[model samples]
Target: MLRGRARREQAAHAGGTPPADDPLDAAQERRVRAVLALGGVPQADLPDGVQQVRLRLLERAAKGEEAPRDVSAWSAVVASRLALDWHRAKRRQERLGERLAALRQPEHQPSGEDNRLLSLAVARGLDGLPDNQRQVLVLRFYADLPVRSIAEELGVPEGTVKSRLHTAVRALRARLHEDEVV
Candidate 1:
């Protein structure tokens, strides 16, 4: 599967048009990819962004409209706009996820008083940790992300994530014990 993907990417960058129906030519596709990349779209998503630009161009052609006077420039502008839209959608999705998570209830409900006290202690302990350590802990535990995924998302090494998790957990545990809250 990966090999096939690699081949497709190579074909894309090689300036080869795959289908007769594709509205954007090879050079146009390359320009679209460059625009999207410089616009902050990740490399993995470039192909999809280029295809989106092509789709819009094709739709315009289907509508019996004259092709844009300069298709290359037009595609680049479209790709840039797509990149901005992508970031907006990503932010919106993240905000919605947070709101949904806040509304979610845990399957097992402990005694309310005990649960409240423990939650307070944990929140306090989390607040006392350094920002990096706290981020690692939350991503690992609350987000339920594996260490490797956290490292990739944060652009840090796995070892760094592991070390931060260990230090944060130890500090929080010590604080809870000291306060007799856990």
Candidate 2:
């Protein structure tokens, strides 16, 4: 059995320190909300927007983007950018869908016949990439951060970031072509 309150997370909004089941600190949530609001995201959509930021960061981390040292600040950056991306995606719904769908199939293959092959091929290629190259690609594409932002977050020069991205893309392209997915 477990013992001690140290193992449990403390809830901040509560009147006193109590164990909180929510993984995100109440303070961090506030930062995320503030960022979303500042980005012109609706107050009504704040929760969903914050959730989007959380999920995106987690997804990027899983895909190989390094977790930030300052999670609260990182979440703010992510929330603001995600809000922008959400608006952009909403503005281009039809065009984005067709383009995204096109990635899974060739000109004649049906869209639903398993677009996963290409995704799997890409995953395999990512696995083969060097750590630095892989991290840059995940940070740029999955986290949707710009080169400068990625450089700041990763503590590297922007030129280094570009080089890693270039190498990563070349490797993935070669892998995909070899696999005949491209």
How close is every model to the real structure, measured as TM-score? 0.49, 0.49
- Candidate 2 per-residue lDDT, tens place, 114-139, comes to 46787789899999999999999988
Off by over 4 Å in 2: 1-110
Off by over 4 Å in 1: 1-15, 105-182
> Highest lDDT, which number?
1
Instruction: Report clashes for each candidate as comma-separated counts.
Output: 0, 0
lDDT score, residue 120, model 1?
96
Residue 32 of model 2 has an lDDT of 87
